[model samples]
Target: MSEPWIPIVMRRDGDRLIMEWSDGFKGAVTWKALRDACPCAGCKEEREKPADPFRILKPNELVPLAPNAMPRVGRYAYKIVWSDGHDSGIFTLAHLRELCKPLE
Candidate 1:
């Protein structure tokens, strides 16, 4: 397989992950987004179902309950240990790269 778009630097900044890509793109991804978009089977199941939009929380209450842990999976992917005890997502480097917002 061809080389992946790996981050040259990956670090945590409060409730977000700060990543600098090999192509010089740098961005921060919030823990909430990461958790909500978790690519694990359980999370995918949760996503496939319809959501009850009535349960919107205040901004303060919407924050991540705990810090996240991201462990590298060899040189191909990163495993996300979510704050709420969800830890089955093995996000690939390409997926992570796709999540990046262009630095304006």
Candidate 2:
């Protein structure tokens, strides 16, 4: 099997998460996309549910996509703490790499 793609650098730049892999891949993803792609069970379920046509945003539901912190989980992942108060997803290196687009 091929070796895992390791992250060489990870950082938040405003609303984007910038990453560089050990294999020379560099990319960035918006904070909103990262939050939406949360891999926690609850978020996963929520994403799987059909979209509600009448969904309305309440005042408190206006969540900011900014990450308050991204702490390393062992050697393979990061646990993101979002500004919206949700902090359960542990994003693996491979998952994160897939979420980003090549930086122009």
Q: For each candidate, give its TM-score against the true structure.
A: 0.79, 0.89
Best by lDDT: 2
Candidates' C-alpha lDDT: 0.77, 0.89
lDDT of 1 by residue, 5-56 (tens): 6799988877677889887899877777777777999889978989868978
How many residue pairs clash in each candidate at the backbone level?
0, 0
Candidate 2 residue-wise lDDT, 1-104, digit = tens: 88799888888788899999999999999988998899999999999999999999866568566888999999889999987778999999889999999998
Which regions of candidate 1 fall more than 4 Å away from where they truly are? Answer: 52-63
